[model samples]
Target chain A: MSDVKTTALVWISPSTWPACVDAARERAPDDHVVLLHVGDDRIAAEAHRAYAGLLGRGHGPERDPGSRLEALSGVAGADLLEKAAHRLGRPCELLDRHGRPQEEVIRAAADADLLICARDGDPERPGPHSLGPESRFVVDHAPCPVLLVWPHRT
Target chain B: MNSLAAEIVSVGLLLGVLAFAVARPRGLPEAVAAIPAAGLVVVLGAVSPADAWEQTHTLLPVVGFLAAILVLAQLCDDDGLFDAAGDLVARFCGGRPVRLLGGVFGVAAVTTAVLSLDATVVLLTPVVFVTASRVGAHPRPHVYACTHLANSASLLLPVSNLTNLLAFTASGLTFTRFAVLMALPWLAAIAVEYVVLRRFFAADLAVGAHPPKEAEQRTVPTFTLVVLGLTLLAFAVTSLIGIEPLWAAFAGTAVLAARALRRRRTTLPALWRAASPLFCLFVLALGIVVKAVVDNGLDTGISRILPGGESLTTLLAIAAVAALLANLINNLPAILALLPVVAPAGPGPVLAALIGVNLGPNLTYVGSLATLLWRRVLHEHDSAPSLGQFTRLGLLTVPATLIASTVALWGTLQL
Candidate 1:
């Protein structure tokens, strides 16, 4: 496990987890993979935080709808991380950060030797070439080299 | 014209800066866009420092009133007022798309009338989309309702739109009088929009609906609602007593702010951060620029052709011209340009011009700042309405609503 010198951080969403894992393995086959799921809880949590702060309830992110997505990401991400480790025969780590996904992915990439991500889907455009704004932002701003796996053209 | 060159420079700088602010290159914030133009007017001596101070002083009450309304809206939004409204509509509609459309109109109209059109656009658009999705309805009609009603329904009250506030200030009508004169036009505009929107989206509205999941309902904030009622009542009472509406707004704001602070729901710094002083500065700066235009012969130039009469025809003509001008350069500047031109013509035409500036902006995407903001909000939700689609709807709705509402205003004057 410690023998693998390469470290890859892969951003995972529930929809994009499978493609991300595959892309991560393809980029660094012998590298230790760390799956990072960034929950989008900032907007609603800000509202809740203000509401709770006013009332002194101090409710955590769990009470918001965003946490449900975070929970799903965690469960699916861990399972995918486990499968990827088995296939690569190396130890892998699964981590979750909650906030703006792109910002979290960038911050979590501090120790990552390579950043892996799937070209996230976009509801605004219908085509094989469409890219989510977050994916574009990550590609443009990521400090480390980014490997974006495009979805298979239908 | 001792200050001809200075006035030209002032107007030129104001127009250029306003365009930049509206276009907002590099995602500049609102204050960043508005504040510098204000500073330039003073620095250029186009507006004397003493006059700038006087102009800003006049705008203070309006700013305070608007800020308080904004705080109230934000607090209501935080307490899930909009989300709960959406959920109630979804649950109560029994998954019927048409009923849901009615619900959307109702919620958007009330939100616009009470909290301002900005609130309707910013807070209610996404909730409408989510509710439509949950019920398996086509979201287009419901989504369009948010923008259409935001403009048309906002005609009823002085606080409904910033333009209304400006008109209110200029008309010198008490709060109750403004509401009375606008009541018929407001109904007319909303009715026209409702009929047009339903017809345009008839095909979409015919889709089968899905059973909505039971949404967790939060208790409506009865205390907040009661305070809102008292605030509105205070508007009428203060007007009767010849007090500025600002005092009433401030009273309500103080109560709400105190409650929030005591309950530890929000902080003073947060409220201060949210309240923009730049808007007051922008209004003052724009007033100075418009004064320059008025001084440099634009007023006299407009006056010669400015159909002089007290007839309904005259009122409608002024409204028609205003509507056209609003489409040309957007409503804010148009109103700033036309206000002095029409004010001397008296209150009937001024209110008609108000109708034109308020309802006419639905004619084009660039007709108002609220529309621009509405478009951006829609884009964030991944539902940008195409320009052609927006125009087509606007063409169907704007003229009909504008004419009908102007006619209603004429009727009010007759009464």
Candidate 2:
């Protein structure tokens, strides 16, 4: 049989990046790993709404705090992805995206053989409660197999 | 139509508008709900066109002030006044979380008192959050200070809050007098807020001992600060000179907008948008809707319930009722509904109601637009406080502030 290298996708978040990176390093050391971080725009949208609600609409893109915030988030997401890549210690593709985190993760995982992620909530419990809505959505709808791990050792 | 039908239609329309505003369903602008509801009230004969016109006339100055202040606040933000303030706070705090909290409190109180609570919530909250994070301090206490002071510290001046603007008009107190009268109550409320918040977030403030990595130096926007100071002084000067404070607000906005445009910091369209014509329209429409409700006898109902006296006990009762109404139906509408009834009693009850509507909103997110916006800011930072946590802190702070401020108002009126 011809040997084909497996490709793995790891979802990295501020709280769960360490655990996901560890899992990727341990289980898929020989595989091609893609580190993905999605910057959620909900905060920017909320900021726009707040500016409009009280201060009135029509704040141009330059003056809008939402735009600046989105820029900041982008910088932050890039930094996170860099950190994750460094921890992986092997050659990896770093992917930075902006949108709904779960949807972005799912879409990024379509071509991968396996997806690695960490449970984002209730780390002490081992039930549905351990996963947040985003993680739950990713695990259920991922195009590839998911390796869900706790954010920390339980 | 019949009196009963008019009352039902007016009340129903107002409630519908308020619900839309509070829920902001599907992220619709409040004007989308308020404008149509206002038109419906007029179309249904619940309010006459002439009555709507009169209400608009009465609200002209308040709306104008609001628009100018919004523009002014936007320009100040664009000029980096808030960012500079954040940098200053960070350096002043020297990486101590407790000191950062106090710095936030001082800046937030002064910002609210001078620039209005909208500025504090929209412009200052993010700045404070960024400052706390940059200084390696837990942001919870500092950011919480911003929202709490936006409400509690807004009791200081007529320009500080929309409710105060309305109450200022109704009370017939000069600009200086309004500030003088409210100063004591404002201080009391701020003191109570600081104490309660310090205690409530004690644990969060206890951590974060690391100093800033490299305290990025930002130059304070001296021009903007000077203009803001001059504008505040102009507020009192114009009030003393027998002109509406809107002119001062407009002049200040014009000066700042001109400077911003000249420096290419903002576009003309951005300046126009900053004036927030749509929001001003919302307030006018809301005023018309509220006027219809009052004319249909909401004022009479409130009058029957409100105690009639300037005594300390009576003032406390008025404040309590105002706080309850504010929490029940949002501060803007609550003040709109209560003002007519309270204004007829005298300046004492009107000021007391102002205290209640301003400080009372800290009790719930729905109680004020500022609180709702503050929540959005926190959510953006991924630090939104849970509803239970917010309510628990509110429970500790709101009543204490409300009562303390009301008592201070009573004492001020005596003096």
Candidate 3:
């Protein structure tokens, strides 16, 4: 039995991507990856995170920091991640981090052999890919070799 | 003085007046519209539309066309097409100012030439401004060059710039013929401009390098791609359909502006509100220009000042006049004010007036609307050149562009 752990962080709009994430799931150690969407310090310290913070104290998303995904982002991500895991004949678990995305993503990179990001959100998608600012940063400064997933434009 | 002399003098004086106005614009459009208004007042005053120039009546359609373009663009802006497109441009060029500047220059030149200056500016400025800020490139030079190049590049295609639009309205020029003739020199000017100016225009900071933590916190629905595709596709289709760029703009703006409207964003209506004011300004300036050209009389004075109206001497003389007028007053007004005077010089010198005036903006920022816009948005950073530095390039490039344009105009005449 192999005993290596890999973490993958995603901080992209799910609307533009559902396919690339599916591919990432098949490749991760657990047939799934630890998804961390860290946030900024201000928001991280707040009792409430996200737009809900505007609604006032004690009235925002009251979930633990390491669980649950944005309904929109989660559906897209979970569905895609599961699809890819199935393709690889592996099993995976979906996780979420609610801190600053870049910082969380960087932290994720420490444990990640591969960080998957959607390239400009191409829905049809290719294998796991990375695009945009977050993805670029991960690739350039990640702890390990970064496998950039790209959309099959052709 | 005779009515002709009076009209020419009026135009000349009006031009001098506008030169002052350029230094003090009551509004943004005022700076650009001054030349056109002065032309209208001068021309209409000198002679009746029928009596003055045979081509005057044909220009009437410009109002409908420009209005249509404005209204349509307003509606599409309502749709979010531009926002989407802008985001994509930003994302692609992201944080690199040098790439962004080059991209903007390329995009602006191509779009302005393809879609007409008025339409191109209306559509592109939002994104260009945002990207410019990220890279810390001043929006001034970008806007300025885009304006001038918008008009200048449009000359190659009758469909490209408003000047070409007006020229088309006022003359019998066709799209194909114009593009075929001016393509080479247009290519040269753009090449020179990019090479000479791109380095100086490099960004003040590394763009797109610092992705805000907001990507995860504030989910702005990944519509950047969708919106970009939709807007670009729509605009391209409209241009292809010959549906009149303005009408296409209105349709698209309607869709994009919907969200902004629903959000009660004052920004949306503010854009619409800009239309009437711009119209009024251009109308006022055009009226003044026409009055100056027709009623006050400045041509016979120009003619007397430079003899031999048809020879090579006249060609060179009018070219010099166009260049001088462009620098002294706004290029639009300079072109309009001198149009009547050059009527006797045949297509050759008439062509000279057109080309020289169009290319003359390179001489000074105030010389062209495009130049003015470029001057307005330049980012202040270590890399961005100061006005004096930019001017040094302009001094060299403007004359070179002018000389090249003169040669291009020379082709129109067998001489």
Candidate 4:
């Protein structure tokens, strides 16, 4: 063997985090694992729009609940990443990002050898419906090879 | 311009303005659409310059009151009134989701009735969302209560909704008399909403968990509560003193803004922005556009369709038509279109139309500006209910509340 380990990027979401983590450990045992969690800021943007629409854009940022929500989401995202790292119980790089979750995952996977994620849609189905829109987009657009795992045994 | 061409152009311009207002293409301010449309109407000779000026003059007080209330609501939010209410609700619910739902309903009703529906959506929705998450309760039911009551519970006071404010000006009733007339209807509508929401979201409310220990330590802001109480008292006093109620709202906003400023909680620029000159201008411009439409003979068509009388059947017909029209063209314009026609028949029809415009928005997202704002709030909190789900709930609640409240209004009229 050349003794060069593969780099795997594992995408973590609140719903299917365990499956991705387990896949990283089982299939890429000796690989360098990078755990990625993306905080969706669309909600924050939506809140800002609501504020601007009703309250006007002149109000200071301190009065906006959108920025407050974004901060809270960041804290929650970090906490989740920590919990995910703890569950992996092995050395891994934790990458926390914000924006569209699928786009962030695809961007983070650019330097990795493999992208690992879980099917987040209908568990009972056995077709494309099994993947959510974000995961579907990630699978279709990822720069690296992808390992898609079922969240639970069907 | 010939009368026929003027009428066609005026209607076309009005439609374009409403489309831009509703779609808000690329998030432009509503005034961006309305001001231009208003100018076009005047310039096209669809409305006389004198008529447009008259419309602006008539709308000044309503717009002034609206600005004051927006400021008051923002300062109150800055003072932590909504957060305190949410915290109190979470603390008292004792980890039961159903109880939390009821608590949210009560608080939302009061907030909408007192501060207007926009406050409940823009300020209280996020607080309730955070509170639900902290308590480990599913947030759907609680947050839905905020939006639903923002529309239905707004039946109580003239100041509760912008539509009510318009109707109040045209209805020629004292503030106390308006509240007294709408009191029973408000109670009935709220009751129907509570019952329907509880049953609709029963599964979500079936489970609950205790709030995190840290959440329990949050303190309520007492000074804000006292000021709010005194503000409510001032509304009644100002009404009795025979002055525009905007004075009371201005006083409340001034006191709260001063306290917020002294405490370094808010700034003057922030206060000015919260007052939202763009939105005020949108309202004024909208008034001019609507005047152009009415002047072009839209009211004659509306008058033919709207039944004229104060009888129970007539009230129901007026309310039903108002509700349908409200859903078709957002409530603000709907009320504007219907008011001139209904106001001539007296307070009974005007109040009935009020009930319709206020309660009708529960049926669709586009039914009211407050509903649209509430939808945005829900989307940001990651708890957006689906269109189908929202409509199903509306179908269950709107008809029941409408009939119950209209009957109640007719009963009050009898008294």
Candidate 5:
């Protein structure tokens, strides 16, 4: 009945997975927390499809988009969700979507009450790229409120 | 030279400097910086350097206090004290973009007021950018808020940052008096900025709002206390020994830098780099303005244009002109140029004008170090609305600040 239960998707970045999971346990209700990500399988498929289009080759074996990232993200997402559920002493669902990372994350938000993201990443950017377009796009159009979780500043 | 010839010569030379700076400003950040200090030097060179650089033993305590304050601030930041403070603000605002903007501004004001603006900006800019992405809001509004906070917070204390430090020391205003002039106008600017920016930010953006269960709470093994004690001790010792204040500051910074590292914890290179452009600009302006004063004398005809016997009236007039000039020429030279000529204007005009010059940058991109840095970051390799973006912001800010500033000056004198 409170303001927080409406959160629908909890997205975890690899570095911040620990912190986001912890925030969710405290704030998200049982069953309200869904671990969602754009599976690497989906991204891989997109790349393959593009390659085939360029070369005019026969249809390649069906490949999921972001196949590798999806696998890695899946393991990370599942591990954190399980750890969080255990800590909260509750049950939670792991929702994975195989597509471009941004689209899948948006779709997950559509089904949930709120979207929570853990802000765990390399402190400095690799070069000048900061807040890639996908993150910027999702922020502008997410279906519901999203929380940016970080190690609570001092 | 005849008076007319001198006036014409001043105008011609002034136009030349502006044209040259405009023709290409980016490549010569250092030389552009050197101009103000160099100009100040020329002015002082023309005058009695002994008088312009004169030391009054009684004035020494204020300098010492500012140096000590910087050490204390460095310690608190090293411990990340402001992070908890940010969470508290975020918690209060909940999930609304507008509420969050206001909260961020409020916290930034206090933080920048307590520490220097550079420290506040360094700690907060990364967090704000990340937080904006999390909340799904454009970083623009938050970026604007950060800059505005710096501007408003500039007036908070004599030791809050260099502009206030310069204004206070050059004009002989006290700490509490400086804060008093700044309080209302600073708050008003924050309120206006938040209100204007509210609708433009993302809709109820929230970066993960919860804290980690295991977040660290340990204190930084402190050189803060040691630094503070040493700074104060040195300050006292220096005044007794009659060391110049600038040299004393440099000595303290060297002493602290030598011992600040713990277990090879690297000192933040960003700390020195973050505000150097501004410091260089200030030093450079100090040189130029001193030179100008030497040529002009303490009461050039222009300096006495107020035509009023009232100290308050004259003071306000000087501050008003100084603020306007600072936008084009920038505050360093503007303040350096005016501080000696203005006589003692009570803490009122001195405080108000200092607020105006520091905040005046809000009116244009080139106005203050904070605005210029933001402009560069946002523009980066590509130009986003270019310098014109800053000019527009300044157009709004200059009139708004001046109007609010006039009221503050009037009220201060009334009280």
Candidate 6:
């Protein structure tokens, strides 16, 4: 175990980018921040191929699906984390994990003192007040205390 | 323990497992939660070992059929058929947003009717979203259409849904007769859906169409298209010959799998991964659980409440109840519980129940597995529709479609 502490683990998605930024802003200057984004490789590959097909292509690139999705999510995460770190005037680490969003988030939260996430609202609900399946699971099972940001106002 | 207490304990245990399966926290696969519950039933003597074995026998065909359809859908996806269809839909719109909505409805209905609702949710949703994005149209209307039409439009053919298959088997109607009876209801349901969806999504539907960029354009596979057409033809032919439809589905799956395998487009392991045996296990376990409930006198009350005539009033009443039950529990379990009750009333009521099970799930998030799967798909893609939004839409559309389709079913039966 390293003597240095990683205080907060923030789960970021394209939808939760703003909430993640807000969490980063709230962190103490000495607090170590690790921002994580989880993406489904299969889904990303499907979307990629579907996008390529829509553009008159037969298939997507023949690269490894897992790495491609990881890279894509990594880039998106790094971009947002970099912006957050620059705003906080400190360095932040971007962690990209591949799998179901809730599972990966729960696994990553084991090492952190605090987990920060936004309620990913369910589409069936009228407003952003309701919690999504992933967010609900994270709040319930994350190893550390969770700070859930409701970014969508009533 | 006394036999009575044991039975009660077993039933309670099974329901708990089912609730977990339905809630599916942490995204546990349905099969993973269900199979163990099934094992519990046998261990508790809620169902005898022999009865459990018999249940497996009954489930094998349904599993095989669903697995085959799933494989076919995945392979078709790998072949870029859905994307090609999506492109065609965009082209057909010719840059109009409303037309794009219409195009999406048509393609989604056909996809749901042919490939099953799950397939539409899995394979077509992303394409719909991407297409909507490309055109700069509101993705909500187009993307939402995939889930709604996937449920409402699936009432048309027996192959369109698992619930429909159950009803078709119970109806004792020939395949052609079943389609004939459902044809009007299917049309009526789709019309009601179109009117409601257009109204609710009116603001979102009004956008300028943008054609697909050069990169998204691809040559559609003419051979695959032909094969799909022939496979559909084979379904009709198999039905006419008194052969089970699963045979045709299996044959079609084999042909498609062979082609995809030969071309090195897909692998055998991919097939296994695509189809979950755990889901089959889940269904079988649910059956045993439902059987335990039914054996404990659930059926007596159900049969009493079931409408007893072929009259339009009776059909409507039965459908209303079925829809209510489906909304309360899921349609799969609802259908399992109520099938015996409805089947006794004749084909008319059986089908009316089918209509309810298929359409009623649109009322809530947990009403059907397909809707849950649709939600998961949207979440994965970073788009979430609020539950209130879904419930509101369901409130508006479900009753209207249910009534319209039931009336249509009555009229068809009269004809």
Using all chains and alpha carbons, the TM-scores for the candidates as numbered come to 0.69, 0.76, 0.51, 0.76, 0.55, 0.70
Models sorted by TM-score, best on top: 4, 2, 6, 1, 5, 3
lDDT of 6: 0.70
Give candidate 4's total backbone clashes: 0
Worst 10 residues of 2 chain B by lDDT: B203-212
- Stretches > 4 Å off in candidate 2: A1-154, B25-28, B213-215, B368-385
- Candidate 4's residue-wise lDDT over B1-415, tens digit each? 8767777887787667766665555557778888989999899998899989987887888878878888888888887788888888888788777788888988999999988887886788788778776675655567677777888998898888888888998888878889999999999999999999887765445443465566356567788788888888887888898987778888888888898999999999888888878878888888888877786788887887877779999999889988987777677777888888888899999999999988887776355443565466556657553455567888999999999999999999998
Candidate 5 residues B68-146, lDDT tens each? Answer: 4455455455555555555555455454455667777876787677656654544554455444433333344555566
Candidate 5 chain B: 10-residue stretch with minimal lDDT:
B203-212
Indicate the worst ten consecutive residues by lDDT in candidate 3 chain B: B203-212
lDDT of 3 at B183: 71
lDDT of candidate 1 over A8-104, digit per residue (tens): 9988653345566777666688777887866454333222211221111112223323233234434444654555456445567878666567788
- lDDT tens per residue, model 6, B1-415: 4556656765576556555664455656566656777777667676778876875676677777777777888888899999898888878777666898999999999888888876676678777766765554445577667777878888877778777776777678876788889999998989998999887765444324456676768779777777777778887888899898778888878888899899999899887766655566667777777766665566776777875888988888888888987776677777877787778778988999898888887776354443454457557767553455556777999999999999999999887
**Interface RMSD measured for model 2:** 7.9
Q: List residue ranges in candidate 5 displaced over 4 A.
A: A1-154, B1-78, B81-88, B199-259, B267-285, B288-290, B297-301, B307-317, B368-392
Candidate 1 stretches greater than 4 Å from native: A1-154, B1-7, B42-45, B48-51, B368-385
Q: Report the lDDT tens digits of candidate 6 across residue range A46-154.
A: 3332222111111113322322434544555565566555655667787877666788899999899888887665333445335655677788899898887754321
Native-referenced Cα lDDT, model 5: 0.50
Q: Give the Å error, residue B354, model 5.
A: 1.3
DockQ of each: 0.03, 0.08, 0.02, 0.08, 0.03, 0.03
DockQ of 6: 0.03
lDDT of 5 at A64: 15
lDDT on C-alpha atoms for all candidate structures: 0.68, 0.79, 0.47, 0.79, 0.50, 0.70
Q: Which 10 successive residues of model 1 chain B have the least lDDT summed?
A: B365-374
**Candidate 3 per-residue C-alpha lDDT over B1-415 given as tens digits, one digit per residue, 9 for 90 to 100:** 5666655555555644443344333323343545554454445455445433333344444544544445444444444545544455455554444555566777777765654555444445544544444432334345444544654555565445434555543444443444555676577667666665653433222212222122422223344335434644554465565554435444544554565566774364565553444443453345444544643446666666655554555666676777777766556566666666665554455656666666665565245443343234322211222345345656756666666655655554442
